[model samples]
Target chain A: MPKQERAEETRRRILEAAQETFASQGYQATSVAEICQRAGVTKGAFFYHFPTKHALFLALLEDWLSQLDQYLNPDRYLGNNVAQSLYAMADLLKAGLTQGRDYLPMFLEFWLQAARDPVVWQATIEPYRRYRAFFANLYLQGMNEGSLCTADPSLAAVAMVSLALGLLLQGLMDHESVNWEEAAPAAFRWVLSLMAPDPATTP
Target chain B: MPKQERAEETRRRILEAAQETFASQGYQATSVAEICQRAGVTKGAFFYHFPTKHALFLALLEDWLSQLDQYLNPDRYLGNNVAQSLYAMADLLKAGLTQGRDYLPMFLEFWLQAARDPVVWQATIEPYRRYRAFFANLYLQGMNEGSLCTADPSLAAVAMVSLALGLLLQGLMDHESVNWEEAAPAAFRWVLSLMAPDPATTP
Candidate 1:
């Protein structure tokens, strides 16, 4: 690999290592030294790549959100109607989760930070807003196309998103507590049933 | 006041104080000294009431579970049909939330503690089981009365419970970000609609 590519790869590795350490030890209890040791990089290298521990933490948050957005992108699931799109979104999340146990801890860490840290809250608020807006838009499309009910679409969208987050939280907190893969499909179907057009008026 | 009633009041105050301190400072960061200070009780009185910090936390958990149970009690909402009972349960929670902001932080603190601490998890699990059982019973009643669709009632019940918790978390975390009181009733009605009897076949 070229020198620049190698340096970029090292930066990614360091960020991943920092994420793992913070997930295990928590952000407050975790240290720059510990992250450097885990990454197998010198403190000088760590400092060159990231100026502060919080900066490294924020970098990890960005990476995680980017991956999440990629998972939930409309293009990936829009081939079918919006109902199928909803199902595919749930399926995509369950697939990632089954492969990414470490990701759950990072998610929990982000929530804890958002609850307590102003800087982290400011950084996360825009992404969070975008997520809610994206769901609202999907609901609006479904309603406009007559695929969904004419009820308040924004509220329906928020309810579905909240349910998904709650399920994800239950799974994360107790890894063995719920069979989320099975549950996820059911949740998607239930949400779809809400959006599905009424059949009573048909001839 | 009677001696027993006075003692109970003191215990309640101490638990409330400990809950607030734990929510603000976290369980590990909160010391017995701090709890006692917040409660305006001496260390001697604190120990007399509860032998240890863990014990105090457990007591707080028990109090919360009982309060939740009373709020969602079938007896309170049982006079009417199953559909009305379900709406009543939702309304009850809405009212409690409006009046219980001070306690909401403590409940979230309990969730964080359960996630990270084994002792707290043990204290929380039984009540969690009770809540699931209560909802399962509610769903069974709805099904038997033909008020709800003929699906797997238990799973539907679980989803409803998950939705409630998820909605509650969003409301708590965002703090009026969604205007949950208005949103909650709408969501509850949507859930009810999904459970509604199929009109085409019902008649």
Candidate 2:
């Protein structure tokens, strides 16, 4: 492989190694030396790609947010009726939950870091605001299409995100007690029912 | 004061000091030395009351949970209709948010610790399960009282708790962005509306 290709490959390996190490040993316990050993990369290579462990964590956050944005792209579900689009988004989230189960602890660690560290907080809030706005826009579009009830889109958006966040936290804390796969969809449907226009007047 | 009373006073002082320290500095960073300094107690005295930092944290958790239980005691709002009971609980929660604003970080730290530590996890899950069961029982009672809609009470309980948990997380992350004081109650009202019996046919 050429130099540029090899550099990209090394970066990928470091990230995968970091994720594995963080998942198993946790963020506080995992060390750069261990990550380098796992990645089979030199310490110089690790430092070249990321200045610090926290920087690497921020990169992971960015990657996760981008992936979420792709999954929740309103454009992908826009052509469908508003209710259908909302359900599609719900389905996507459920899939993400199942796929990301192994990484949940890492995500919690990210949240904890965001709560404690100013640098992480700054990195987190922007994407969080974007997601909130994205959901609000979806609510507004649903209302405009007359498929959803007339409610303040911003408040509706907050409610939607809150339910999602709450379910994720509960699932993390009590994975065995609740069937999140089933519970998540049910909760989403309940929210949708609240948002849906009254059926009696539809005919 | 009597000897036993003086001992209780010292324990209370240590807990208060610990809460303050954890709120300001977070769990991992705060040390027993700092806690003792804040409490104005000797290290020996601190050890006398709690065996370890983790034990002290567990004590804090127990205290918070009991306080929450007292605040959310169903009997306080009993004899009123189910919808009224729920709204009352929401009011209580909102009051809690306002009163506990300064302690939110401490609560988040506790949650993070629970996620990472097995001892903390055991302490957390039991109280969590109790709260879930408590909410589920409330739902069952509402249905029996003919004030709530017909639905699976367990699922409804989960949904309610998820919304509350979501709101709390959001409040911690973006306190300035959202008026949790208002948003919390509004969300609760929306959930209550969903659970309430159909007014059109109530006569």
Candidate 3:
């Protein structure tokens, strides 16, 4: 590999190792030395790629947000009915979660860190606003197409996002008790029922 | 003051100081020494009430949960219709949160600690299960009484709880952007609409 390509590979390895370490042992308990050891890189090399542990965490946050953005891209579901598109989005999240069960703990760690640290707070809040805006636009589109009920698009957006977050948190806490795969779609349908126009009241 | 009265006061002082210190400085960074100083007590007095910092955290968790229990006591809403009961519950939570805005950060800290620490996790999960069961029974009652739509009560319970959790999280993340007091009841109505029978469809 060329020198730049080798550096990129080293950075990727460090991030992977950081995710694993943070997931298993958590952020506060995990140390730089351990992360370097897991990445199979020397301390100097790890420093070269990321200035601090906090910076590494920020990078991970950015990576997760971008992946979510791609998953929820409106362009990919352009032809489907609004309800179908929403279900597809739910299914996509469920599938992504099943594949990345290890990521749950790390994600919680990010939330906890963001709650306490101002720098992390700024990094998290901007992406969160963007997500809210993305869903609001989607809700407006669904209403304009006449497939969904007329409601405040912003509040509808908040409801959808909240349901998703709640399910994720509950799954993390009680995976043994609930079948999240089945529950996700069921919950999505319940929310969609609220967003559907009333047939009986239609003139 | 009597010795017994003096002792109780000291314990309360320690807890109040711990709540303040943890809220401002966070769990990992705050120490027993600081808690003792803020409480205006010596180290001996601090350890006399609580054996360890972890024990103090557990006490705080218990305190918050008990307060929630008091707020959510179903007896408070007896004779109200199911929709009314549900809205009352949402109002109760919103009121509790509005009063305890200072506790939000500490609550997140508790969750993070529970995720990482085995002792905390064991303590947290049992109470969480109890809350879920409590909501599940409420949904069953609402459905059986004909005030709610005939759907799977357990799923309804999950949706309600998830919405509340998500709102609490959003409130924590962006309190300036959202009026949680108004949003809570509005979101509750949205979820309740899903559980309510359609007047137009009913004969």
Candidate 4:
């Protein structure tokens, strides 16, 4: 392979190895030496691509947020009715989580790290607030377009985020207990039901 | 102090010291030596009451759950209507969290530990499942008692747990983003309103 192509390959390998180790052993326990060994690259090659382990962590964090940026981009979902749009987003998250169940532990790792490190806390929390805004904005848009009923859009967004967080946390802790696969879609439907303009459906 | 009373006092002091240190430094970072120093007790005294650091943690865990056992107790709320009962429960949790906001970090510690260790995982998850059952049972009772509308009680319970978990998790991380004090009661009331027999309120 060419020098440029080989460099890209090495970078990808390092990132992939870091992801696996961090998820299994947690970030604090994981070391550059271990990541290098798993990636089958020399320590010098690792340092060349990523100067430090912390630098590698930030890159991984950025990659996560970029993948999630789609949730904020509503251009595709905007055309659909709000309820439909929400179901689509729910389905997307559910599918991603189902495929990456082991990766769920990695989230607990970040959450614990953010709890301790101020800098990491800020980096992790900034995107979280953006997601909150994204959901709140969608609720407002839904209300404006006559697809939803009256309610505090921000509060509604809190409920949505809480539902997702709570379900994911419980699911991570006890695999068999939280049926998030069924619960996530059901929850959205229930929340949408409450938001229906007509209240005649409550029996 | 009497011998029995002095021993009880020592245990309580040790527990308090452990809670504070664990909250500030986290479980892995905290040491038995540090806990003894904070409690102003010798390691010999500490071991006399609790054989190991792990044993001290288990005592704390048990203490935590016994306090929460009231949420599962229906006799206190059994006299009131279903909506009233739900509000009381929400208030109970909200009040506890508000007062113990600092202690919230300890929760993250346990959650991280449970994710890593199977033994700790079982101890943590068993009570969680019981809480799930308690919520689901109340939902079912409400429907039968003519206070709640039709819905899957188990699913509703999942929503409740998720909302609480999600809100608390966010509040612990960002501190500013989640208004759980207001949101928790509002979310519960909203859920109850959906369960109300009247359908004229949504508009």
> How high is each candidate's TM-score?
0.85, 0.89, 0.89, 0.87
CA lDDT of each prediction against the hidden true structure:
0.71, 0.78, 0.77, 0.74
Runs of candidate 1 with Cα error greater than 4 angstroms are A1-10, A96-100, A124-128, A175-178, A197-203, B1-10, B96-100, B103-105, B197-203
Error of 4 at B55 (Å): 2.9
lDDT of 3 by residue, B116-169 (tens): 798887776676567778888987888778777746877877777777777777
Q: Which stretches of candidate 4 lie over 4 Å from their true place?
A: A71-79, A197-203, B71-79, B197-203
Q: Could you say which candidate leads in DockQ?
A: 4
DockQ of 1: 0.40
Clashing pairs in 4: none
Among the numbered candidates, top lDDT falls to 2
Candidate 2's residue-wise lDDT over B1-203, tens digit each?
99999889999999999998877666767899999998999999999999999899999999988888888787897656766677677776577677676667677677667767888887777766777788888888778887777468877777788888787777767778778889877776676677883333357
lDDT of 1 by residue, B1-203 (tens): 99999788888889888877876666667899998889888899899899999889888888877777778767777745676677666665466557566665566566556766788876765565556577778778877886766367666765776677777766655654667777765676667667773333356
Give the least accurate 10-residue stretch of model 3 chain A, judged by summed lDDT: A194-203
Return the lDDT, model 1, position A96. Answer: 58
Worst 10 residues of 4 chain B by lDDT: B194-203
